[model samples]
Target: MASEYVLRIPLDRHVITTQRSLAAVLEDIRRVLHDSAPRSALQGHLVAAGHQVRLIIDRPEATDELVRCLPDAGAYCPATVLVQAAGDGACLAYDSVASAISPYQDEEALAVAELFDAEVLSLLRRVAEPAPGESGQ
Candidate 1:
């Protein structure tokens, strides 16, 4: 059986409000992931709710040294990253499972979570910044 790991990163309300904004944010995220993890393959689709976007990242042949350290790392499962608009704010989530049997599964999961957290937060900062002539609210 596989155990799942999830990491949630919250975003400001103004960051994502409409379908156009969501699409822009998703594209930015895709670019960041592509640059950071070039080996990973990405696929995106809209969820049934029509308010969420899900991005699938497959790294079956992961070349990262950290992932390589885990036993049977070649069998690592794909990760699902979701962006959803909540009540007053938005949220970015990273979900993946530990499909391989290894003593370092938990550790690997944490490491992956941290990586996603950092990347998402960094992206948020860039996207949430105010324009040159506008004051941040």
Candidate 2:
């Protein structure tokens, strides 16, 4: 699998999350997931952000570990992230909840964020060799 994506979101006890996306692709996806999936006690808000989804955390130290992994890009793709108080968490204000998010960004961080964003994006690559009985030149 190609490795070049990360899902970094911070969590806190109280977070106000609002978001807009660089591209329009996840709005529909968030609507469907939110409308159907059963809410978990641990989950806060999994809402839509233009074409992406907003993942807001409401826990302690949730962002500490995550911030260490990601670069401080202020408001960039993957998230228009915001870190509040020291104990406060982060806001991945764009989840691309519809299209899908690339999970692997680096060797240290694997495609683990797929679990958090709850979506998967396929790596672009061509498969060598032909399938059995398939045409070959």
Candidate 3:
């Protein structure tokens, strides 16, 4: 089987009540990523399964850093974010950055990918979790 990197987060009602719609969640994710890495690019937005939205992010800056260590590693430039409304509330998923770069097995590439993974994962978690004393809209 082909290798894969995926993160799936189950949503809580408070998050759903705050973010109202998938579009809002997407916007929140986009905003968080933008804040995290302004240089990275948001490449596309897509619809899936009727009620789901996906965001495609191309981090040339991050890839550029990786390429310095392994020039042939340009294929994994863009990453994806998927959000779907479900019976519980909502689910957000994405490919794992480490899994994406692990094929190279290069120490430098793995290190960079690990850092990228941490940053993006943190961003997604922040997007899904509401702040203290703040009601979502």
Candidate 4:
């Protein structure tokens, strides 16, 4: 059985800025995921260096749906994105899809959750990529 985990992707610069806003990146993610900018169940925080967004995706393969089917599914509803200041850069972090599906040992559910993991990681990595013409290390 898989266990809970987190995936953190570092960015070349601060994403939570008016120039390269985290909001914009989040909106982009929503479009890619749902084709609409769904409301975030929770938004913004002072504890983090920059900002954070939390939203529940109630898709057929999401945590909410999984819980409805399998009661043992953990409290994975509402995925999260944290933009934390990293020196002059930033980091985009989130809980792995496996983290939410791990509590349920159902092999079928695990396979579906793995798909979510790949999609989420791809979106985050795309968001963290440096813009065109921008230097990256």
Candidate 5:
């Protein structure tokens, strides 16, 4: 079954300074995924009003493996991600899930969500890192 993962990366100070814009960061992620997992169908676009980028990754194995490699790929900013699997329901922000209605089905779903969060955060940090000899301004 195909699992849909939505990555919502905000254009914060770190992102703005490193990536310059949401489009740039999204493009970087697209390139990374393309190079790392050629078979995974990756689709991404910017949500201008929110000043963030949303990346949709299809396929379960591809999503799991590709996301794991992202942290090592390059620098970027960390953001919330939503993972939705058919029949498995959806996993949202943990802190907000309590006050807001949740679709979380089980612990396994939460584990996957956490994994995505960590990997994505690492990926963003890598993306935000300064190049060669340039100072991270």
Candidate 6:
């Protein structure tokens, strides 16, 4: 009923065609990200970014796959929102519940932030959301 989360990444021009479930899509991204970097290094990147932050992703294949994964029921807040496009990158704005917590507020929170942030950054730098020149195909 309400917007939950937003995800942004580099737009790839070739894979925007078709849609898939959100979980499956994110799972792909997660796998790619983990494979691309070490946990400690990703966490350090987030720490260096100064705690809370926002980002943009431009990968379309990945985004379309994520859109396909959009669950029919039971999805975590803000993590559920599809990315919004502006210029070259797309932005994911999660619901307030997702954005309100600060990684620095507590150890557990920090851990959560580290994990997600790492995933986001890894996707941003290493993976393309779709094939080149793909836009909503």
Clash count of each predicted structure? 0, 5, 3, 0, 9, 40
Give the per-residue lDDT of model 4 (tens digit) for 6-108.
6443322212322334555555556566543334222222233335454444344355555666555545544455654344554566666565565556776
Let me know the TM-score candidate 3 reaches against the reference structure: 0.64
Candidates ranked, most accurate by lDDT first: 3, 4, 1, 5, 6, 2
Locate the minimum summed-lDDT window of 10 residues in model 2. 120-129
User: Per-candidate TM vs. native?
Assistant: 0.41, 0.24, 0.64, 0.56, 0.39, 0.28
Cα miss at 38, model 6 (Å)?
18
Q: At residue 106, what lDDT does model 2 achieve?
A: 41
* Candidate whose TM-score is highest: 3
Clashing residue pairs found in predicted model 1: none
Rank by TM-score (best first): 3, 4, 1, 5, 6, 2
Task: List ranges where model 1 is wrong by over 4 Å.
Answer: 1-20, 30-37, 40-50, 58-67, 72-77, 95-117, 128-137
How far is 79's C-alpha from truth in model 1 (Å)?
Answer: 2.5
Candidate 1 weakest lDDT stretch, 10 residues: 11-20
TM-score of 4: 0.56
Cα misplacement distance, residue 53 of candidate 2 (Å):
11
- Evaluate model 4: give its lDDT: 0.51
Per-residue lDDT over 1-137 for candidate 3, one digit per residue giving the tens place of the 0 to 100 score: 89977544332111222243455566676565555445564334444556667666556677788788877556554666667765434567766666766666788887876776666666667766655664444
Error of 2 at 8 (Å): 17
- Model 4 ranges off by over 4 Å: 1-61
Scored against the true structure, residue 128 in model 4 reaches a CA lDDT of 62
Identify the runs in model 6 with alpha carbons over 4 angstroms from their true place. Answer: 1-81, 85-99, 128-137
- Superposing all C-alpha atoms, what RMSD in Å does each candidate have to the true structure? 7.9, 17.2, 7.3, 8.7, 13.4, 15.4
Superior by TM-score: candidate 1 or candidate 3: 3
Return whichever of 5 and 6 wins on lDDT.
5
| Candidate 2 residue-wise lDDT at 27 | 31
| Residue-wise C-alpha lDDT for candidate 5, range 1-137, written one tens digit per residue | 99988544333222213422333444455565664443333323323325233444333443454346443211221233332122222111112111111133334433544454445555555544545774422
Return the TM-score for candidate 6, rounded to 2 decimals.
0.28
